[model samples]
Target: MNEHVPDPAAKLEERAKRKAAKREVKKTEIAASTLDALKQLGYANTTLRDIAAQSGMSLGSLTYYFTDKVELITYCVRLYKAEFIDRIEKSVTSAEGRDAVIDAFADELTRSMTEDLPTHRLWYDIRSQAMFDPAFRPVVEEIEGKLLETLTRVVQAAGQQDTSAVPLGYAMIDGVFRFLLQSRDRHARDNDELMAIFTAILRRIF
Candidate 1:
């Protein structure tokens, strides 16, 4: 005769998994509401109370997750970080080595800029602060460093190795990013024209 025994290890693992799932759900709720509040009111104008209210949670709850507004913005920066790299990487890969990589990049840049106005505004808002806010420098630097690395990889894959042109290549994209984000509210800009500019500059650099 054999006796059945309960697996203590399996039972403990299941409990741990349930707790982790609950924590993840709570974190997702907070991040979603936090991002919504930022999109609506922007960084400087948005407050903890506003986030708590929008989230349907108490101020204490918001504080429990994030010590302050700085932490919230830092979290947002981290959240969007992968997207930036992915967008660039996709643009580069989509064009293949023979197609105009710069034109493909411009398409990706235009897609986000034209379609995502709220985020466009948020970026400009943060960019405006980067000049005056010392605390924001590191966040900005982290983004810049990652973008440079991604572009460098693209250049390497395209059979280009001159690092000297990296800065120029970055300048091209930044100009396009800003133009799409900055001018559309007041003036009509042509996406094709922007693509032309990007392709022209990229060919020389690569």
Candidate 2:
């Protein structure tokens, strides 16, 4: 009689699944703690050691979990970009017509990104850091690509294909973003007004 043995392929698949689940958990923990560190230390000052300490993990552990600072920042960017895009897409898709859809999309986007002061601060940190560092440029570009992709799709769906409108739309928000964070401290209430004006621009272009 031969001893029973587990199938090797099944064993490997189970191991892989477990590894993936563990990675997901670690990613969540890292994200939460890293964001907290970002708040406390700001973008340029925050280090991997700080994040590891906050998360109650060793630097080696964080290294195993993330390739580098760029990877971690990219994760944060992905989270924000996804939230922004999801809200805008939902509002636009659910609206009755082109005008309403564009307006609602703008409103939702502004509402999501600036309704919280911390969110605006975090964005300011990431965008500023990306501008000076070679390591972060790709991450910023990737985030920007995702952002513009969402806007472009929405604009096209609304019945226009002005390639220039993509950057123009971006400029409108960038101007508002700069004004909010730099020219003056932004309040939550300003979100509604910003959204209205942005939508007005999109409506004109589209």
Count of steric clashes across candidates, in order: 0, 0
- For candidate 2, the C-alpha RMSD (Å) to the true structure equals 3.1
Candidate 2 clashing pairs, residues 3+ apart or interchain: none
Model 2: lowest-lDDT 10 consecutive positions: 180-189
- Per-model lDDT: 0.75, 0.76
Q: Candidate 2's C-alpha lDDT?
A: 0.76
TM for every model, in the order presented, reads 0.79, 0.82
Q: Model 2, stretches more than 4 Å misplaced?
A: 1-6, 161-164, 184-191
- Give the TM-score (vs. native) of candidate 1: 0.79
lDDT of 2 by residue, 1-206 (tens): 99989999999999999999989887977897888888778877888888889999999989998978888877876776677778777777867667876778777756655654565587767778777877777877877788788878787777676767687877777677666556444353466677776777676667
| Candidate 1 accuracy as lDDT | 0.75
